[model samples]
Target chain A: MPLMTSLHSEASSMEFPALQAVSTEVERATVDRARAGDQQALADIYDWYMPRVYRYAVARVGNTHEAEDLTEEVFLKLLSAICDFKWRDVPFSSWVFRIAHNCIVTHYRRTAQRGGPTSEIPLDMIDGRHDIAYAIEEQITMEEVRVAAAQLPEAQREVIALRFAVGLSIAETAKALGKREGNVKALQHKAVAKLQKMLIPVDGK
Target chain B: MTEFEQRLSECLEALVQGRLSVDECLEMHPQHADALRPHLIAATAFARTADQQPSAEWATTARQRFLIASGKSLQEAMDIEPEPTFFASARVRFLLAAQKLRQERSTAKPRRVPLFGTPMRAVGALAASVALFVGFSGYTVQSADAALPGDWRYPIKLQTERVRLAVALSADQKRDVQFDIAEERLQEIEALAYKGKIIGPGVLNRFVEQTQPLVEQANDGNLDAGDAARLQQVSIRGTQVLDQVEPQVAAGAETELAQAKVISDTGVTVTRELVVKNPDRPNIVITPQIPVSTATPEPTEAIPTDEPGAETPTPEPTDVPATEDPEATPTEITPGEVPTDSVVMSELPIVEIDDIKLHTLTAGRLTLRAPGPSTGWYLDGVPESGVPLLVTMKTQNQQSFIVLNTQNGDMYWYVSAASNNRFDEIQMRLTRDGQVFQADAAVLRYFYGDAAEIPLLVMNSIRILPEASPTPEPTATLESEPTPPL
Candidate 1:
């Protein structure tokens, strides 16, 4: 109750700003507007971080529809809790990213339980033209990279998303994730190492 | 920095900057990136998915919810752009959820009460789909130059390689197939959890065995579900194990992995580990050393009773010699009291009576026509009203009045004859305490009474002052009507 009461008090004090300042300011504003019952404020908040959220979702779920819905739900969740949001402890984006990650993880668990396809056909498999230049310059190789990433161990893939897609600083991601910064950094190291090994050519070798 | 860290940083920076495209990202760290880039690419792919604007129907459906939360219909809300703030968005999200709940209420018939200790079921895939299509306009794919045809060949080649790698008839290929099968099994366990199926260690072991192959194949670049499924089917003959496992498997793997991470860690432990053990109760041997104590009953005394019916004949009286015994019972009167029958009420003298009608002089403070009624009225118990047989009760200390209105219900309290100095103090006191003053109009019949009690005035304000408080009486005696004046 104290946490909730204190959070509510802080939420009331921090209101949304119309024009953007720094990303931090934008985040504060989003939280404030969400607390104030502005549904559109939620949409705007989603719009700001959705690209990253969507990227993370797709990385884990490997489906556009699922990723999009998951991303939306994450924002919706954040919006719902806006009234009692706090800025003292953790970075807001990290928290939101954590939600997105959790949903993807849940999706994976569900589909695996159902014995659905685990080796997902890359999103490009579902639809072509992910990037026009890739299609023009080198479709075959880029497609291989996409499939290869999917083939990586789930842990490695997670590290990639936390590091690359979410752009979380090691410490922020670690805290958001309840992990040691060292462990997260190690994961990033291994994940990127694995990804690089799997996708590059060894012409000299 | 170590070579790996340095290369990883350069590669990641390039990846984040878009300077190193997916192919380039893969080129830099082929075996690693090829296995991992799919995730980032998948993310990119979903981000690029075409955005479907919410349909009018969806907005209409959400309108009622908006109305309830914001006092604005969905159409109205949508027509106006939302202000940029988290609180607003949160409200919108709640409004949306509320709308969904309302729609569900309208269309669905409720059934199946929740049971205690049961886990919550995941949202149905169909329900999830509806939420997506209705709330968000489906996945939006971007059409940037980086995601076009030039990059199409790589993924196709990868898929083709996977197909070959999965079905390769070699021993290594079979091993790869087994790993794929293992991965499929793990996925099945995951799917089970997702579908809300209960599982145990046996199922978990099977899941691990099934997923092991996939992990191996994943490492070997022999990954592709279609090929894996085909090979698994050919080997197992319609086991449909993969089909049964993948959905929940995906969900399960993520959960199990997350839970495992939460439970334990190598150096730089990731999360706090919690272990719950249900140990068996220990056996105990006991010897009876002392007797158990019992309670003793209490003693009771009883009086003798006799049944009377037939009387016996009297015995003859024999006179023994008259002797003065000191023990003889004495028949002497004790000193101070007189017998109750000797007192007489008939000796009292008669009192004079007068007849005149008196109106209520003031509220709380009652006055009667002095020259008319000699009868004293007792209020509760004490003589108060001037008219004979008048009574007033003080329920609360607040000065309440027994206002006696005339038969026609006129305000008799204001009568000039009833107005005087004695009444003024009573009114002032009653005003201080908030009590309703009323006089029983029926008491007017008592106007003719003896001069001993001329115009009896009852101070309903008896308890109004701290001094006139009634002696505490038994609660049982309080309800009875006071004895009528003789």
Candidate 2:
């Protein structure tokens, strides 16, 4: 219910890169074709937001497979919902992510009902690419980021994950979370202030 | 937002995108520089975490599933709109997934499903072929390449790949070709993961073994950008991949995990060694990587590991350890031998991952071999087909076979689980983790080759005793044949 507060938030000082994101002329045409049952156009939409959707889902869900399943459910749900979606001032990207965020939240609730989700980072399928080994550093950083993120208060975590993990513009994140742009900014600043302690290099070396 | 705060937000966004330097950021807002620096640092790190790419397998599946479910309702996972939404302009009804469309119609009534953009007849023909695949096994091979694993032709598909390798001209050509094939293997794993199909450890093991040497080889030469980019993509992606794969390995593979680390640790040294001497070798192109040291620091040893994940400020490696021969064979040396070379320059701790091979098999394969004991060997009951599987297992007594169907990107879970015999320690280990075997271990070795060519594969036993030899070809002769049917 909190996420569905869908009326557009008032404008604020921070400019939303709304044009650069969801409402581009090409995107509008693609939406048009998608509504007309052009599968390719719908596929294009999947291509554009999949990585972002996945990043958000994975960070939120903490498992690739679960994240993937949730993402698929979100898209499938979108198929029925898309026709009814009249573009407000909000970006289409935000609407989809809102759906995805709800999907993940519902998943956690259901899994939690069954017992808490597995605490162990399910090390089930190993992917040891040579270059991926070099990315070991990035992976370690991400894991730490993941843990640190999980530790944040709910609102702060939402802002951080939406803005950073999903690569959303400030306004898009605000739209997706159903919050004012200024409120999103304030939450982001607080979240960063907290993470700074966690991420700072010791001894300043 | 005040003008200062507005500029501050822009600077922070730029910092997160890695476009603005911390000093330049501070310069823009001299008054708020100190207050904002720490937040900028946090934002930058979050940005880095966001930069991680989802596994290619996940990406491919997301697109296909969307295509497959074009106008479907999530409830029944169908596209047959009992009630269609009205469109203001000309509406074009694209054809649907036949399966979903079929389900939508009342089961009591049978009717022909019409095609829209693409012809329905062609798809119908393909469906008929798939149906035929189940009826006759051999008919599947010709169309096997397009088959996904679990399809009837998957075994022939695996055999087809083996046949291709058998005819390769030279060892160098074979290795190069194998590297290319390994990428295909990775794509396959991604494809399987995309479909939510079961990917066993064996399949991933094959790819891991294939790529280990390739990863090692990459460090010896100055990497071109394309190659470096490829390697980086694999390495970064491997993190999430490890999350998917590690639970499947039987415990004995702990030893295998260490070997993979040697390659990564060695890579770190070569990359560092080059950078340390960059003033001399300026022309050799390099990936702009700030190597993150994953090594445990010791008081007496190299303490200046990159320390990327933990920000504990260990001093940079100022001393270089004596060089151990980089060429020393991985297994020949003491297992998990920490590289001592950082003492020679700077004290960089040797950060080695325990087993990258075991991990990569999430996207690779498992190979089985036995040189001693029962020279006539079998995996999952099928007679061993390929030559000692070109892996560096400690001994021939224990082997892991990760059979993958070449036509399809699916893993042969049967082959992998077969190695999990009652006596097998690996099985015990897998059981210790939460992996439960879904199908029978007997399925592991049942070969589905040409009915004439398919050996009466011995079931469940890894070793084929001489008395029970199904096919009496020498190991050399077997080298020329394809992997026992996928």
Candidate 3:
């Protein structure tokens, strides 16, 4: 199918690498130790997952301060609820992302109660790199994509965030969202199509 | 799924797995290529855009906070002592001794000793209890003495007050203890307000519960001269503290603060009258002059002003007798003339819904705008035991219902579409006396949209009437009928 050849051009330009699946044995051991109240294991889990959680939070909330607060709240909730975590088919990462997802939902609800605006793409997310022109181009693209993504329906937006932003597999996304894998696939397809229609004109320009 | 959707999902997965490019996927399925290209590009762009990294400094600080929080969690799980070094050591020793006794009982021969089988163990348990009591009485109580709301020691302080009240034998003794506790609550409120902390409804409720009885006693002339004098001192102190702290109180707690201010003002008025009746009473010494600027007049003004000689000179808390001639009649200070401060209920405009006037409805000390018959909102009926005045109101579409506790000021707005469980709905702490009310955004946006202002207006129109009344019964029973739609 020449899939590898076609993928290479797009893959080579990819600035943010996709999340690699953690080795099941290693993750299981760490999770088990954490469940046993091992502080080091918990710290290890936090160190490994904090950035991913922060990225997910930023994508969902679109503000650094709120994201930071949500990130901290997620970790604290994990600390309290981890003991009740049963080792099931669901991966630990999915469990952690679920916590982050719920926190974002609550954050949105709270913001709504305050009658405040939700999700403004933070300008500071644009990196100040040596290549000024490239940096500006990259910054503009990200902002445009984020602004478009924010317009997606809540379910579709969440699906795209977990699938593309957090790099969760379709199955993992389903587990985290408490949805069927088929539902996740349908939501992702709809989200991607909507984003395409919204941004295609902008991209052509 | 549509053939195109299936093809897109497959290609998207392959691309996400980093094994297939957008062009390659389209090349493999040329029929779907035109439709797939833009979607693939959008997905890729979003993936790149959403991949955000927090600043290094923030990450470092966040990690530090996470670790600290995790440590505290671990300490709590392990049940580590939060006491001083001495108490911690004593507690550790006590736990160790208990553990040793448990081990000894498990390992030693299974034999009962004397009337109390395991006499040593019983003695150990007794010793532990004694130690706990001693430790609590000595250190915990001393520390809790200064504890404010939200402090870990605050519950202990409340427990100790309950203990003091429980131990008092006579009615007068209990009343005295109640007065002391009431003063303590005022002090806690002052301390919290001074630090710009929120005075929650719980503290305000307790303060009213404690002081209301004593205020009533003085009003009814049931209190002895000594008790009346003490009531006067407390009322004065309460007035001074509330006035000083009024500006410092946080925004949401204003209703509770206003209610408390009314109680204090009422106490001041009632006690001053008692003093007037017994002018020669040794305890009728000087009471601090209330600054007219800070004195709220709602409570006093609400009383009928029909008496010819109602206005009296403000009583100065001095040692001088009330009258120059001991034989001469004392100047009477009528109850109606006592200056008091509260949110004036009369100022609230009468709201008419569907041509039905919503007049002020009084229940105990609480007065609110009674929901009009045609307003869709109904007074579901106050529980026979008059607290929390739960008035359930349904929206026009019957999609949501709000359960408002008009007494303690908790408003629970529930959307039927959200969850069946009421707890999942938006629960807002309305200001006591109904000064400020806010609606949750999710409920408003998802359901009400442009009509969000309807709920806010209804809530704002409701007012808490601050008339001095006896304490309400504690329990509540909700009405059975489901509220109808607006």
Q: Write model 3 residue lDDT over A90-189, tens digit each, in one string.
A: 7787898999999998988888899997656566566565276656656666677788888999999898877777777898899899999999998998
Residue lDDT tens for model 3, B1-486: 999999988887777666776667878999987777778878887776656677887787666545444443444333345446535333343333333434454456465555555657656754654454232123443466689999876755665565456435468877888888999988898888878886666777678888999998888888987888788788878878888877766677678778888888888777755653464443211111212121212555544444434233122223321222211211232233222222112222244443433433433333344343345454454454545446566645565566765454345655443232222255443443324434443334322343334344344333333344323335432344556788
Candidate 2 chain B: 10-residue stretch with minimal lDDT? B355-364
RMSD of each: 32.3, 30.5, 24.7
- Between candidates 1 and 3, the one scoring higher on TM-score is 3
lDDT of 2 by residue, B248-288 (tens): 44466544444433443444344333332333322321111
Residues A1-205, model 2: lDDT tens digits: 1111110011111221221245579888887656544455677787777777766776676677777777777776666566456677578878888888788778878998999654313333223442554355445555666677678888898887787677677888889989999999989877887886665543331
Per-model DockQ against the true two-chain complex: 0.04, 0.13, 0.23
Q: How well is candidate 2 docked (DockQ)?
A: 0.13
Q: Runs in model 2 with CA error above 4 Å? A: A1-23, A118-137, A201-205, B1-7, B15-24, B71-486
Candidate 2: how close is chain B to the reference, as a TM-score? Answer: 0.24
lDDT of 3: 0.62
lDDT of 3 at A188: 94
